[model samples]
Target: MRGCSRRAGRAARKRRQKCESSIQSVSLGHQLQYVRLRKFLHQRGFTSSLLQPALFTDTGRGLQTLKTIKPCQLIISLPESCLLTTATVLSSYLGQYIKSWKCRLSPLLALCVFLVCERHRGEASDWFPYIDALPTTYTCPAYFADGVLAVLPAGVRRRASEQRRAVRELHSSSRDFFGSLQPVLSQPVEEVFTYEALRWAWCSVNTRSVFMSHPSNNFLSGQDHYALAPFLDLLNHRPDVQVKASFNDATRCYEIRSVSGTVRYQQAFINYGSHDNQRLLLEYGFVAPGNPHSVVYVDADLLCDVLRGDRSLDQKRKFLKENNFVHNLTVSSDGPSWRLMTALRLLSMPQTLYRQWKAVLLGQAVCEEREEWSVHTAVTLCQRLLQDTNAALEKISDLLRQCDPAVREQLDVVQSLRQEERCILGRCLEALRGTVRQPDEALPCQPDDNDDDDAVS
Candidate 1:
């Protein structure tokens, strides 16, 4: 009897455990059903087959079970009823949206949209009827002012306005991002300190500055007559690079225009900051065959290798033969020209020599009187390219004669003509002017004794 009771107790315990396991299994089914139902709601035309079976399976009994389904999934079984229910819910939640949509679909609104789109129609009939008619501007609540339409219907106006504003915001932002290059061009080179900063700063200023700073390190020397050619000036190198433009010509004056290809201006973009400090090298002579606009300099060596054949070694030879090729005349801190050093002074000193010249010409002084005179001296050198040649020569001669009549008498260098003797004389006058103007000016003349031995090298 004791064994029999123990066996019966064990059986009862196992049965209870089995019942609990079935209950937990059903709970798991409910979880799966929830996920399936949510996914169904998100789908287009999702109403029936999905929810009905899942709900019936989870609850194990419902009107959805093909019997008593008035309150449950069976409603979805009837397509028309399901759609009606959806419309009712949507109307309750967003009645304003529905009313606005209705207005847009109305005949009057359709006609207005058509007319606006047809305004530019070239056909006579398009505008013939309304050409002389006074445009009747409707006082309808615009979509711009309200979040819902308030044209008699408050919510409708506001909703329309909100949509319109959203669209306008998108359009404006896009316009700002993808608009023309004009705004970028108008920015000054000074605004961007480095080549990298100039990437987005427009092409004009950045390219010009780059050309000024990194011009080919070339200078022509012929006995007493030596000058920096504008050939490399056309290159317009950036400041970071140490090279400069160097070229020569058979003519007395350095002809920069010879090397300036029509498209050389476009090559300026090669040194833009955004382009990894790369330079552009353009070479084309085939289909566009030697077009001035087709010549460019790029930074990529691989591209250079690929287009190496395109690079006119023959043209380069021709260029060199026609014009004298010269050596690099890089001016260091200690150069012959005080004006050149002063122009570069802006790097160490915030005051620009150009600005100083403007002050002096206007009869103002930023530093010592002699230094102000030095500023004026600097301006004369820069103006040599454009100002009256003979007058400039006389001005220097007069200034030289005032200081040392003997030296002026010895070197009868006239600035009027392009000659070796004249250039040498002008240079001598420039040196005298510097010394007379600023006896105490700490001009970086020659390297000091304590300076490093390789200062010039």
Candidate 2:
């Protein structure tokens, strides 16, 4: 059977009151939608009796076990009819009009269009319950209010602005396509295709969809393929948790297995990748404390800034460009990635030493002699980053002190984001500062200049 997940309805027996909403703030309509969706899934044999979706203080509404569950247990199973695959939408009546979309647009975009139109169809739509259950507000930084954006670190704010721009472009492209279909589309459909509606629908799909291979023999999608699994969306994220999710052809359903088991009353979580909280916030609209993938994004531009206007900096710039060491640097949970630290070390090296290290940078040799100043150089670079981070924090602090109540609520999220990233950078900087240098310790080697290992092996 497909290892599907359904955690909405109460079990057969009367349940404890602890299952009540933690905040008691969930709308009655939302609770009713879940009840209806669960009823529908149960009638269709796609729900489990052992667990139900419940509100948790830390994770909003997620699946919680009502009964003891063992590992590899059949959590829930949904048949082909319930699977929200590309084929599901593409095969719909309106879905046929978009055959050209298959080639012209992404399958994700196709699904987004399907979701928007179907949602506008309301009760006439097949997935009303699921649609109604989705969160009305997304908390990702990209969606942060203007005041919030005004107070954030330039790096994070820049990222958010870029993402927002990209989304706007996506919405525009989709709207143009919708306009082309105007003659064939009904009035309600046309209205729903507006940029605002499509934007909401796209975020709905973007935030909740999961990759599930289409099970039909004719469908040849894989792990990268996506579908909007009903019960699965209710599971909150845990950075360390993993899912063994796939479609089982013989059973004609999609199945899911959590890497870890849940006991009665404990919430079950799925891994949204090892994404640090920053990624979680940006992509998933929520941030987890102490995310494992958390890191300080050390911009390549910062490294370049130091090199600009210095003598022979031209040569160093050429070397950086030739070597591709100038981009994608990060101070991650594991400390500065090998590329960043090593690049900083070489950048710290005195000119003649760097000439010798040119062979090292170009990958022609392995293991350059570690100069006494290498640690000092790396520390200096890290300190520069820290100084920038601190200045950004001070800017935010100044904004918070202004006490504009209207923006303060929104700024809370932005402030937390800044502090979190600052924490990651601070931890990384402190470690880099304290490293007791092994005199003549072998400088970590880049692969041979001719080798491809220079690409972050």
Candidate 3:
């Protein structure tokens, strides 16, 4: 029996090893493209070989270190020649048309146009390998379908709409410029520069481009700070990772130095400037789960509803707006943000204490009664948010059941976002409840009818 058990255990180990080997094989399937990209970069002076493209189970596609990289080591240094910038566009076949155009083209639009034109050229283009390595379809809000957009949280959905509108307006305004490209293209300008084509190009540039400031150019309408770095852009963002990236004047290459060391064969990361999950999803089409910077934003309308019975609602609203405190009110794991608490404190004050508004803003001590009122108001607001978040999550679950596989993927992102907000709200509520003397009676603030005579004070 002991001999049989040992044989069975050895067989199981063999099966596990085979499964892992197959998974590794599948993960590196994109090596061919990376190979071509490496060759392309090497010819143009990309020398650092510490990192290589690999599929990470957690981050999808990211750069993994080929060797253990020590802190402060230079991880990548791509020569300026390898970077695709507006300068590249200005020197291309479309440069003459762009230079002679009646109005100057924005740096962003120029990059989009260049990307679209080169993508159209395919294998014939010089930057084909770099362009080919780009994601074919980005998950940025600009690419989200209407159905997917509808399920997003109110704040995210609003921003998503603005993003879509901006992309559409850009496409509409560039028709004349696109037409000017006809002399160089085999296909009609409309066929080559369709809205979808421009949208794809726009997302590619927006999501992946690295910042590289270029000197002022008369032909470009905006700052020339955008550059599409080929293999370097593959470094995914992690909130904890720190890196110093700059254009090294001495080296004549765009360099990224690791402030944080990476383990061998592990995914290497760079910090993307401490972005919240909301901003990450909106701008980059992905969210960092448990992002420390994440917060649940309090909508203005909802806040007003929570403070509906306050006699000085108008005054408080104007005060908040004037102080720039009307926006960015949020709840995080710690509790209500200072801005939200301050807003609530001012709004919860009785008519008799109306003159103390400025003192409240300055964080002066409020009377116990007023403090309790503010706490109650915050608790009420948090409960409402929790209710709404729970309802939205349930709705997303239902939609997930009905959605196709493609839509399901988009819905999943929205679900993750909502779930994070829910967790934040729950924590905020628990914290608020613990502070209330009569937690059960922590009702919404009501208009002080007896203090009406002092309302004008």
- Which lDDT values do the candidates have, in the order given? 0.25, 0.63, 0.80
Clash-forming residue pairs, model 2 = 2-255, 3-255, 3-256, 4-76, 4-255, 7-53, 276-294, 363-448, 363-449, 364-449
Worst 10 residues of 1 by lDDT: 277-286
Top TM-score prediction, candidate number: 3
Better of 2 and 3 by TM-score: 3
lDDT of 1 by residue, 1-457 (tens): 0000011357865863454235311121245434443343334233332222211221121212223322112122111211111122223322333233412222212222223222223233222222112112211122112211221111222333553454344334323222222232234323322222211111211122211111221121111111111111122222221221222223212212212111110111011221110011100000111111111111122222322333233333233234332111112112223323332221111222323333333334333433443444343333332233344454555555554443342122222121222333344445445444455555432112222222110
lDDT of 2 by residue, 1-457 (tens): 0011222347611232244333232222246788888876666677677667776665567777778767777776667777676787768865646655434566667787777777777777778877777766566654666666766555667877776787778887666667666655558445767666666766777778876654443222223377787776777876555677777889988777866577667776667676655566567766665565667666666766754534555566567767887766677644677776666655544455554566556444333334334444555556786686677667767777886664564465556666777677667767765563555664432212122222121
List model 3 lDDT by residue over 1-457, tens digit each. 0000001367865863464344341135257777778889889987656876777655678777789999999998889999999989999988998999999999999999999999899989989988888888777889888978887777788999999999999999889889988988889989999999999999998888888889998898878889899988988887756799989889888999999687777677887777778898898888776677889888898888877767778887898798788899888988999988888877766666667778777777665666677777778778888888788888889888897876777777778888888888888888777788774564434645446322212
Candidate 1 lDDT score at position 117: 22
**TM-score per candidate:** 0.13, 0.77, 0.90
Candidate 1's C-alpha runs over 4 A off are 1-363, 369-441, 444-457
